[model samples]
Target chain A: MLTLAQQLWIGLTNGMVFALIALGYTMVYGILELINFAHGDLFMLASFLALTLVGLLGLATASGPVVVVGLLGVVLACAIFAALINRTVDRVVYRPLRNAPKLAPLVSAIGVSFVFQNLGLFWGGLPLDVMGGGLAAAAPKSFPDLIPSTNLLGDGAAFRITAKDLVVIGSSLCVMVALWLFVTRSRLGKAMRATAQNPLAARLMGIDVDRVISATFLIGGALAGFAAVIYGLYVNTIKFQDGYQNGLYAFTAAVLGGIGNIPGAVVGGLVIGIVRALSDQYIGAQWQQAVVFGMLIALLVFRPQGLLGANVREKV
Target chain B: MLRVEQARAGYGAVEVLRGISLTVDEGEIVTLIGANGAGKTTTLHTLSGLVQLTGGRITFLGENIAGVPAHELVRRGLVHAPEGRKIFSRLTVLENLEMGAYTRRDPDGIARDLARVFELFPILAERRRQAGGTLSGGEQQMLAVGRAMMARPRLLLLDEPSLGLAPLIVARIFEVIRELSKSGVTILLVEQNARMALRLAHRGYVMETGAILLADAASALLENETVRAAYLGE
Candidate 1:
C-alpha cells in the first residue's frame, strides 16, 4: 500500500490540470450556451505550437530563468493562437447560427473539432511526438524540476511539493479567480450574463450582445492556451491525436461540474482528477478509464442537474 | 411628438397592424383600448421597432426613425418598457435602472433621473440592491416602470402596465400615470382593462380586428353605450 497521504498528494497535483481545462469549457458554455467542443483540441494544438517553437529556438541550451522565460514566451504565443482560433471559430461557425436552429451551432462545433484535429495531423503527421525519440527529440529539452523538496512539515510531511506543481496550482487558481470576477464584477461580464439569461432583453438594454459573445470566445480561448502551457510541462509530450481524447475528457469535466456553472468546473475537475488517480493507483491503470467514467455515470444517474447546476423551470 | 403613417407590419406571413396610422401630440397621454387580438400590443411593438414595419414611416422628433435599430430608438428618447416586466433577473434593481441609462453620456443627469425614479417608487429605493427576481409582482412592475423612466424619455411606450397586478396596485399605477402625464412625459398606453384605462386617458382609441373602431374624448367613450356594454360593464 502506498499510504493515503501519498495518494492524496498525487491526486491533488493532477487535479490542478483538470480544473484549468474545465474552467475553459464551462466559461465558453455559459456565455454561448453551446459547448466549444474544439476547445481541447485548441489546447493540444497550442502545445504543439510550443513544441515547434522550442525546436526552432533551441530553448534547452539556455539555463536558469531563461528556460522558464522561454516557456512563458511559448505560452504567450499559444495564448494568442488560441484567441485567434477561437475568434475564427465564433465568426465562421457560431455567429451565423446565432438566430438559426440551435442544433446548427452544436453540430458545427463537432465538425470544427474534427477539422482542427485533421489540421494538426496534416502539420505534425500521424506519429505521436513521444513515439519519435519522445519529446526530447523534438528539441533539446530538459525537464526543469524547479523545486527541491523540503522537510519543513515534520520531515517528509512538509509539502514534498515541487515548484512546477506550485506553478500549476497557482496559475490555475489565478485564471479561475480572474474569470469568476470577470463574469460577476465587470460591466462586460454583467452584459454577458444578461445576454445568457435573455438576449432580447439584453439587446434592449443597449448591450451589443453579439460583441459580448465574441469576447466570451476570446476569453475562453486565452485560458485554454494558458492551460496548454501547463499541460505540456506536466505531460512532456504532444501529438495530433492527443486533442480528441484530452479535449473530450476536459469537456466531460465541464459537464460533470454543472455545464453552465462557473465555479462548478473547478470542483468537477478536481473530483475527476482525484478519482482517476485513485482508480489508477488501486484498480490498476487499465481499469482507470472505466472507473472514472463509472463515477460520471453514477453521478449523472443520481443528479442529472450536475453537482452545481441550477434547476431552472422552463415554461412549456 | 410621435407619428405613424400607413404602418403595415405583422409576423412572417400573417398581417396584424395593417395600414395603421396614429399620432401622439407632444405631452398628451394617448391610450389605445382593444379587445383580445385587437392589434394593440402589435401596434406598440411596431412603434418601438420590435416588429419591423413593412410599408410605413415613423418620424419621432422630426427624424425618420421608422427602421432604426431598437436599441438606437431608445437613445433617441422613445423607450419601451415592454408588456412583461423583462427585468434582468440576476441583476439588482439598481443595476437594472443603471442599464436604463446605458446610452446616455450625461452621468449627472442620469443620476438625477435615477433619483427621481426612486422618489416616484420609494419601495424601489428601499430594495435598490435586491435582485429584481425577488421582488413581488407589483414591485417588479414598478421596477419596470422605473427602468423606463431611467431613460428620461420625451415619449414613453407602456404596454399593459396593469396586466397582472392586484386591483389596488393597478389603481396606484394609474395614479402614477396621471402624475406622469401632468409632468409632461407623453405616454402611449395600451391596455385590456378598458374601464380604468379610459378613466385615466385624456383621449382613447378603440381597435377592433386590426383597425381603429372609435376615437373620442375619455368622458365620451366612458358614456358611449356599446363601450359601456362591451367594456366598462356600466
Candidate 2:
C-alpha cells in the first residue's frame, strides 16, 4: 500500500512537469491549429539556460535563502529568454506562412525544432563549470542539487515526501491556477479566446490577431521555461535529446486531452504520468512507452474527443 | 462618411470587385442590393478592409483608407458586422459585446454603449451569459448587431442582417436599423432582400457582376421598372 502511495506521489510530480510543457503545445494549437514541433526542444534549451545560470551564480554550493532567491532569478531569466525566442521565431518563420498552405507552417515548425536541437547541442558544449568542464556535448549533465532532498515526513516514513516534491507540485499548481485566471478573466486573454474561435470575427471586433498570436507563443514559451527549471531540479539530469523524448510525451498528453483544450491538457498529463509510473513499476521501465501509447490508443478508440473535451470546442 | 472610387480587388488573380465605386455621406443609410454572385458582399468587405484593393482609392472620414488592415479600420470607427454574422461562438453574449468595444479605451463611453445595446436588444441582455453558438438564428443576428453597436460606430456597415430569420425577426432587426439611423449613426447596409432594403434605406445602389448597374434614391429605384423587375421580384 505504501509502495503504491509512493509511486502515485512520484507520478503526480512528474505529471505536473508534463502538464506545464503540454500547455505550451495546447495554447499554440488553440490559436494557430499548428502543433509547434519546436516546443519540446525549446524546453530543453531553457533547462540548459537554467544550468548555466546555476553555474554562473554558484547556487549549487550555496546554502539556505540564497538558493531560493537565486533559483527565482534563474527561473525569471529562462522564462524571458525562452519567451523572446519563441516570439521571434513566430514573427520570422511562422508569420510569413500565415496565408500559405497549412502544411507550410507545420513544416517550418519542424525545421525550427531541428534548429533548436542543434542550438541545444551547441549550448551543451559551452565551457560552464556545471556542465562538467563541457567535455561531452551529447552527455546528460547532472543538475545541481539546489533543492534539498530532505524528506518532510522524516527518514522512517515508508511513503517519503521530499521538499523537492512539494516545490514542484506546489509551484506547478500555482502557475496553472494563475494561467486559468488570466485566460478566463483578463482582457487580452479574452481576446486570445476570441481569436482562437474565429480570427476573422476577432479582427472584425478590432483585435490585432497577429499580436494575440504572438502573445500566445510568448506565454506558451514562458510556461516551458518554468517547466524546464522544475524538471531539472526534480529529475536531476538533462540532455540535448531529452527534449525529443520528453517532448513526444508532452505532445501526446496535449492530443490525449484534446488538442485545443486547456484543462484537458492538464488532465491528460496527469493520466500519462500515472500510467508511466505504474507501468514502470509493475510491468517494466523498458515497456513504459508501449503501455502508455497502448492506453492512449484504447482511450482514443472509445473517446476520440478526449476526457474533458465536448463537441462544442473552446480552443484557448 | 465613406467613399470608394473605382476600387478593384479580388482573391489572388480572380478580380471580384471591378472598379466598384460608391459613397456614403454622413448621417445617411445607404443600401447596396444585388444577386448572390454580384459582388455586393465583396464591396462591403473591401470597404471594411478585409479584402485588399488592387486599384483605386478608399476614403473614410476624409482620410484615404486604402490598404488599411481590418482591425485598424475598426479603430477608426468603420465597423463591419460580416455577412455570416460571425460572432465568437464560444464566447458568452456579454463577452462578444465587450470584444466589439475592444479598440475603444473609454470606460464610461463603453458603459454607455453597453447600456444602449441592451436597451436596443433586451433579448441579448437576457442571454448575456449563454454561449453565442447556442443562440437561435434570430438571437444570433441580434447579438451580432448588438455587438456592432457596442463599438459606438459612426459608420456601421451591416451585411445581410436579415438572412435566414423569420419575417417577424427580420422586421425587428430592420426597425432597429432605422432607429440607429435616427440616433445619428451612418449606415451602409447590404442585403439580398431587395424590397425590404429599399424601404429602409434612404438611397440604394444596384450591383451586377462586380460593378454598379444603377445608383439612385431608394424610392426612385423602387419605382424604376428595371430595378423592380430584376431585384424586387416583380
Candidate 3:
C-alpha cells in the first residue's frame, strides 16, 4: 500500500496542473459565458510545439544552465504561439456571434476543437526526432527527460519528493499566485471583473468591451501554454489525444467549483486530483474516472450552483 | 449644447423613435415626459449611443455624433445614468466610481470628481467598501448618478431617476438634479412622472406614441389643459 503522505504529494502535484488549465476555462467563461471547447486542443497543440522546439534546439541532452535557459525559451515561445491562436479563434469564430443566440458560438467552439485535434494529429506525424521519428502518428510521443529525477530529500525517505515534482508544483504555484495578484491589484483586472458583471455598464463607463474580451483570451491561452510545458515535463509522455481527457478533467474541475469564480477552480482541481490519487491506490487505475465522476454527480445534486457559486438564480 | 434632428431608430425593424427631434442648450435641464411605450427612454438611449440611429442626425458641441460609439460619447463628456440603475453589482462602490473615470487619464481631476460624488451622496462614501448589490434601491440610484458624476460630464442623460422609489427618495434625487443643473451640467431627463419632471425642468417636451405633442416652458406645460388631462392627475 502506498503511504498516505506519498499519495498526497502525488495528488497535489497533479492538482496544480488541473488548476492551471481550469483557470483558463473559468476566465473565458466568466467574461463571455461561452465554453471554448477548443481550449483543450490548444493546450495539446502547445505541447506539440514544446516538443518540436526541444528537438530543434537539441536540448534533450544538454546539461546545467543551458537546460534552464532552453526550457524558459521554449515556454515563452509556446505561450506567445498559443495566445495568438486563441485570440485569432475568438476574433474569427466567436466575435461574429456576439449577439446571436448562445448556441451558435458554442457549436463553433466544438468545431474549432475538432480542427485543433486534426492539427495535433497532423503535427504528431511530422518527421521530428523528439516524436520518435514520427513512425506512428497516433502513438504517444515520449517527452525528453530534461529534469533530473533524483529524490530531493535523499534516496532513503519514505515520503519521497523528486526534483521534477518540486519544479512542477513550485512553478505552478508561483504562476497561480502571480495571476491572483494581477486580477486583484491591477487596473485591467478590475475592468475584467466589471465587464464580467455587466458589459453594458462597462461600456457606459468608457471601457472597450471587445478589448477586454481579447485580453481574457490572451491570458487564458498563455496559461494553457504554461500548463502544456509543465505537463510534458512532469508526465514525460504525451499523445495527440491527451488534450481531450485533460480538458474534460479541467472543465469538470471548473464546473465543480463555481464556473466563474477564480479561486473556486483551484479548489475544485485539488479535490479532483486528491480523489483520483486515492481511488487509484484503493480501488484501481481503470476505476479512477468512475470514482471521480461519481463524487461529482453526488456533490452537484445538492449544490447545483456548484461549491463556491453564489446562491442567486442562474441567469440563463 | 446637444441637438437631435429628426432622429429615427429602433430594435431590428420596429421603429421606436420615429423621427423624434429635441435639443438641450448649455446649462439647461430639459425633461421628456410620457407614458410607457412613448419612446422617452429610447430617446435618451439614442442620444447616449446605446441605440443606433437609423436616420436623422445628432450634433454635440458642433461635431456630428450620430455614428459615435457609447464609450467614445462618454469620453466627449456625454454620460448616461441608465434606467434601472445598472450599477456593477459585484464590484465595490469605490470600484464602480473608479470605472466611471475609465477613459480619463487625469488622476487629479478624477479625485476631485470622486470627492464631489461623496459629498452629494454621503451614503455612498460610508458604503464605498461594500458591494454595489448590497445597497438599497435609493442608494443604488445615488450610486448610478454619482458614477456618472465621476466622468465629469458636460451633458448628462438621466432615464427614469424616480422609478420605483419612495416619495421621499424621489424628492431627494430631484433636489440633487436641481443642484447638478445649477452647477452647469447640461441635463436631458426622461420621466414617467410628468408633474414632478415639469416642476423641476426649465423646459418640457410631452411625447405620445413616438412623437412629441408639445414643447414649451415648464410652467406653461404644467398649466396646459391637454398636458394636465393626459399626464397630471387632473
Candidate 4:
C-alpha cells in the first residue's frame, strides 16, 4: 500500500548510486572502447578502504566537525588510492595490449576483475574494528552509520526523506554536474573527445592520445572512490562479493542508456532504479531481478543503439 | 629545413619505402609525385612518424628526428594534413581548429593563428558551428587545410589534398596551397595529380615503387619526356 511518492524517493536514492558507478563505466568505454569489467571491483575495494580508514582514525562515534573532517579525509584518500590503482592497472595490464586484438584487453579486464575481487577478500580479513574486528574473511562487514538518519521533513510527513538520502543524492548530483562541465568545457576534455573520435587524427593534432586515455582512467577511478564512500554510508553493510552485483547493475545501466553516452548512463540508472523499486513493491521480491533484466532485453531489441546512443556505427 | 637520407620503412613484412632520400629547403614547395601504390603516401607517413623508419635518417632543423612520435613531430612544427580529411567528425569545425593548436601554449599566438585560418577559409568561419563530418567534400578539404594552418606549421606535409574532389574544388585547393607557400611555410606536397603538383612545386621528386627515380626543378620535371609521358599523361 505504499504511495507512488515513496516508491519514487526510494528509487531516486538507489538510482544515484547506480549512476555514480555507471558514469565510470561509460567514461572508460567512451575513451578506450573497453568494458573495464574491473571497475566494480575497484569500487568494492574503495569501500573497504573507507572502512579501514574509519577504523584507523577511530572516527566511528565522532560527532559534528570531527566527523565531517574525518569523512572528507576518507573520501580524499580513497579517491587518490583508487585513481592511482586505476592508472597503474592501465599501464600494466591494458597499455601493453593496446594494439592487440580487441578481445585480448576485454579478457584481461575480466581477469583483472577476478584479481580485484580476491584482493577485496584478503582486505576484508585484516583485523579491524569497523569490519567487526575481522571475525571472518568471507563475512559481510557493517559500515558505521556516520551519517545521521534524522527525517528532514519533520516526523509528520506521509513520505520521509532522510539526511543520509540527501547526502547521497546531493553529492551524486554535484559530481555528475562537475563531470559534465569538465568534459564539455575544458581543454583536456576537448582532447579526450577528439581522441575518442579518431586517435590518429588526434595524434597528428599534437594531442598525446595515451595521456588523454590515462586521464580518463584516473577521473573514472576517482569518481568510483567517491561513490564507494557514499555507498558504504548509505548501504550500512558491504561484502567482498558486492562488486560483482554492483558492477553488473552499473554495466547494465550503461548499456541501457547507450554504452558510450554519459547522460544516457544516468538516465538508464534512474530508470532501472525506479523499475526495481516498483517491481519489488508490486511483484514478488524474487521476481524483481528478472523484471529488470527482462526490460533491458526488450528495450535493447528495439533500440539496439541504446536509448541515447547515436545511430552511427562505432569506429574501429 | 628537412632531409631524409636512405630511409627504409613499411608495415609488417611488406616494405614500402626502400632507401628513399629527399630534402626540402626552408620556404620551398617540394612535391612528391607518383602514381597510386608508388609509396608517395607512405613517404609522407614516415615523415610524420606514423610509419617507423626501419633504416636511415631524418634531420629537421639541424636535429635528427627519425623515430619521433607523430605528436612530438607536430610540436616541433612538422605538421601533416593527412591524405584523407580525417577531421574529428563529432566535433564542431571550431573545435577541430582548436585541436590543431593543441601543442601551443601562447594564447595570443593561438588567437592570431585562429583568426588567420578563418580569413584564409572564410567558408570555415561561416560553418564554425557545424560538425566536421556534416560538411561537403570541398568544405571538408578546406577545413582540413585550415586546421593545419592553425598549427602555425613551419614545414607542412600535405598528402593528396586533391584526391577526390570536383575539378573546380581541386583548383580552389591548389590556389590555397600556393597562398600557403607564399606565406613562407615550407611545404612537402604529395599528389597523384602530377600536372598540378609539379606546376605548384618549386622542386619535384618522381617516386616509383619505393624509391625516388628522379629529383630536379619542377620546370625540368614538367618538361622531361618520361615525366610528361608517365605522370603528366601528355
Candidate 5:
C-alpha cells in the first residue's frame, strides 16, 4: 500500500500540470468570456513541435549542460510559436464574430479545435525520427526520457521524489507566481482586468480592447506551450488525442474554480488532481475521470459561482 | 470645436438619429433637451464613435472623425461619461481614475489632473481605495464625471448625469457641470431635466423623434412657449 505522503506528492505534481493549462482557459474566459476549445489542440501541436526541435538539434544524446540549454531553447521557441498562432487565430476566427451572437464564436472555437486536431494528425505523419520515424501517424509517440528519474529520497524510501517531478512542480510554481504578480501589478495587467470587468468602460478609458484581448490570447497560449513541454517531459509520451483528454481536465479545473477567477483555477486544478489521484488509487483507474467530472457537476450545482468566485449577478 | 451635419444612425434597421445636426463651439455648454426616446443618447453615442454613422459628417477640431473607433476618439480628447455611469465597478476609485488617463503619457500632468479631480469631488479622494460599485448612485455619477475629466477632454459629453438621483444630488451634479464649463471645457450635455439643462447651457437644441425641432440660445429656448409646455413640464 502506498503511503499518504506519496499519494499527496503525486497529486500535487499532477495538479501543477493541470494548473498551467487551466490558467490559459481561465484567462481567455475572463477576457472574452469565450472558451477557446482549440487551446488543447494548440498544446498538442506545441508538443509535436518540441519533439521536432529535439530531433533537429540532436539534443537527445547531448551532454547534460547542452541538454539543459537545448530544453530551455525549446520552451522559449514553443511559447513564442504558440502565442503567435493563438493571436492569429483570435484575429482571423474570433475578432469578426465578437459582436455576433455569443454562440457564434463558441461554434467557431469548436471548429478550430477540429482543425487543430487534424493538424496534429498531419504533424505526427511527418518523417521525423523523434516521431518514431513517422511510421504510423496514429501511433502514440514516445518522448525520450531526458530527465533522470533517480529517487531523490534515497533507494528505500516509501515516498519517491524524482528530479523530473521536482522540475515540473517547480517550474509550474514559478510561472504561476509570475502570472499572479503580472495580473496584479502591471499596467497592462490592470487594463486586462478592467477589460474583463467591462469592455465598454475600458474602451471609454482609451484602452485598446482589441490589443488587450490579443495580449490575453498571447499570455494564455504561452502558458499552454510551457505546460506542453512539461507534460511531454513528465509523461515520456505524446499522442494526438492527449490534447482532448488534458484539455478537458483543464477546462473542468477552470469551471470548478470559477470560470473567470484566476486563483480559483489554481485551487480547482489542485483539488481535481488530488481527487483523481485518490480515486485512481482507492477506487479504480477506470473510474477516476468520472469521479473528477462528477465532483465538478456537484460543486457547480451547489455553488454556481465556483468555490472562490464571488456571487456577483451576471451583468445584463 | 465640434460639428455634426445631417447625422443619420440607428440600431440595425431602425433609424434613431434622422438627419440631426448641431454644433458646439469652443468653451460653450451645448445642451440637447428632449423627452425619452428622442435619440438624445444615440446622438451622444454617435459623437463618441460607439455607434456608426450611416450618413453624416462629424468634424471635431477640424478633422472628419465620423468612422473613428471609440478608443481612438477618446485618445483625441472626445470623452464621454455615458448615461449609465459605466464606471469600472470591479476596480478601485483610484484605479478607475488612473484608467481615465490611459491614453495620456505625462505623469506630471496626470498627477495635476488627479489633484484637480480630488479638489472638485473630495468624497472621491476619501474613497480612493474603495471599489467604484460600492458607492451610492450619486457618488458613482461623480466618479464617472471625474473619470472623464481625467482625460483632459477637448470636448466632454455628459449624458443624463442627473438620472435616477435625488434632487439635491441633481443640483450638485449640475453645479459640477457649470463649474466644468466655466473652466473652459467644451461640453455637450444631454438631459431630460430641460429647465435645469437650459438654465446651465449657453446654447440648447430641442430634439423630437430623431431630429432637432428647434435650436437657439438657451435663454431664448427657455422663453419659448412650446418649449415650456412640452419639455419644461409646465
Candidate 6:
C-alpha cells in the first residue's frame, strides 16, 4: 500500500494541471454552450510560442533575475496573444451564429481546431529543430526550480513529493478561488450570469449582451494560455497538437463537474486528475482513456444533468 | 405622456397588434382590457420595445421610441415588468432589486427606494435573502413591480401582473398600483380581468383582433350594457 504522503503528492501535482486546463473548458462552456474544440490546441500553441521566445532570446541559459523576467514576458505575451485570438474566435465564428442554429457554430469550431493544428505542424515540421538534438525534441524547455522546495513533504520509497508539485497545486487553487470571487461579487460577473439565465431580461436591464459574451471568450482564452505556459514549464515539453488530448480531457472535466458552473468545473478537474493519477500508478497509462470515458458515459446515463447542473428544461 | 399612432407590431409573420392606437396622459392609470389574443400584452410589449413594430410610430414623452432596444428604454425611464414575473430566478430578492436599479447611479437614493419597497410589501423584505423563484406567484408579481419601481421610471408598463395569482393577491397588487398612482407615477396596465381593470383605470380601451374596438372612461365602459355583458360579466 502507498503511503499517505505519496498518494497526496501525486494527487496534488496532477490536480493542479487538471484545474488549469479545466478553467478554460468551464469558462468557455459557461457563456457559450459550445465546447471550444480548438481551446486545447490554443494552449499548446501558446506554450510553443513561449518556448520559441525563450530559445531566441537565449533566456534558456540566462541567470537569476533575467530568466525570471524573461519568463514573465513570455507568460504575459502568451496571455495577451491567447486573449486576442480567443476574441477573434468569438467575433469571427461564434458571434455571427449568435442567432443562427447552434450546430453551425459547433461545426465551425471543429474546423478551427484543424486549422490551428495544421498551422502548428507547418511551423514545427516533422523534424525537431537541431539545437539540442533529441533533447529539444524530447523536452523543449526546463524551468529552473522556481517552485522553491519540491521535497517539502516527507519523501517515500515510491513517490517523491516536490516543491514544484506544491506550487502547481497551490496556484491552481488560488486561481480558481479568485475566479469564484470575480464571478460572484463582481458586476460584470453578475451580468454574465444574468445573460446566461435570460438574455432578454439581461438586455432589458441594460447589459451589453454581446460585450459580455466577447469578454467571456477573451478571459477563457487568456486563462488557457496562462495554463499552457505553466504546463509547459511543469511537464517540460509540448507538441504542436498537444491541445487535442488536453482539450478533450478538460472538456470532459467541465462536463463532469457541470458546465457553466465555475466551482463545479474545478471540482470535476481535481476528481478527474486523482482518478487519472491513480490509474496511471496502477492500471498503466493506455487504460486511462477507457476508464475515464467509461466513467463519463456512466455518469451521463445516471445523471445527465452532471454533478451540479440544474434540471435543464431547454428544448431544441 | 405616451402616444401610439397607428402602431403595428407582432411576433415573426404573426401580427398581434395591427395599427392599434392608444394614449396615456401623465399620472394616468390607463387600462387595456381584452380577450386573451386581442393584443393587450402584445400592445404593452410593443410599447416597451419587446415586440418589434412592423408599422406606425410610438412617441413617449414626445420622442419617437418605436425601435429602441428594451434595456435602452429602461435607461430612458420606460420600464416594463413583463407578462410573466420574469424575475431572475437564481438571484436573491435583494439582488433582483439591485438589477432593476442597474441604470441608476444613486446608491443612497436607491437604498431609500428599496426601504420603501420593503415598507410597501413587508413579506418581500422578510424573504429578501430568498431566491426570487421561491416566492409565491403573488410575491413574485410584487417583486417584479418593486423591481421596476427601483428603476425610478416616469412610466411603468405592467403586462398582466394579475395573471396566475389568487384574487386576494391580485387585490393586494391592485392596491399597490393604487398607491403608486396616488404618488404620481404614470401606469399603463394591461389585464384580461376586465372588471377589476375597469374599476381601477381612469380610461379604458377594449381591444379585439389586435385593434381597439372601443375607448371610453372606465366607469362609462363599466356601465355600457354590451361591455358589461361581454367583458364586465353583468
Task: Tell me the interface RMSD of every candidate, in Å.
Answer: 2.4, 3.4, 2.5, 2.0, 1.6, 2.8
Error of 1 at A30 (Å): 3.0
TM-scores for all candidates: the values are 0.88, 0.97, 0.97, 0.96, 0.97, 0.91
**Model 3 Cα shift for residue B21 (angstroms):** 0.5
lDDT of 2 at B80: 96
Question: Which candidate, 5 or 6, would have the higher TM-score against the true structure?
Answer: 5
In candidate 5, chain A reaches a TM of 0.97
Q: Clashing residue pairs in candidate 2, if any?
A: none
DockQ for all models, in order?
A: 0.47, 0.61, 0.64, 0.67, 0.66, 0.47
lDDT of 1 by residue, B124-177 (tens): 999999988889889989998888887788889898999889999888888888
Question: Where does candidate 1 clash, by residue pair?
Answer: A153-A158
- Interface RMSD of candidate number 4: 2.0
Better candidate number, 2 or 6, judged by lDDT: 2
Off by over 4 Å in 5: A310-316
Q: In model 6, what is the error at residue A296, expressed in angstroms? A: 0.7
Q: Using TM-score as the measure, which candidate wins?
A: 2
* Candidate 3, residue A168: how far the Cα is off, in Å: 1.7
Model 5, range B1-234, lDDT digits (tens) per residue?
998999999999999999988999999999999889999999998999889999989999999997899999999989998888987887899999999998999999999999999998999999999998899999999999999999999899999999899999899888888888888899999998899999999999999999999999999999999999998878
Ranking by TM-score: 2, 3, 5, 4, 6, 1
Tell me model 2's lDDT, rounded to 2 decimals.
0.91
- Candidate 5, what DockQ? 0.66
Report the C-alpha lDDT of model 1 over A175-229, residue by residue, as the tens digit.
Answer: 7788888887877887777776656666666677678888888888888788877
Clashing residue pairs found in predicted model 3: none
- Give the winner by lDDT: 2
True-vs-predicted CA distance for residue B84, candidate 2, Å: 1.3
Worst 10 residues of 1 chain B by lDDT: B82-91
Instruction: Predict model 6's lDDT versus the native.
Output: 0.79
DockQ of 1: 0.47
lDDT of 2 at A163: 93
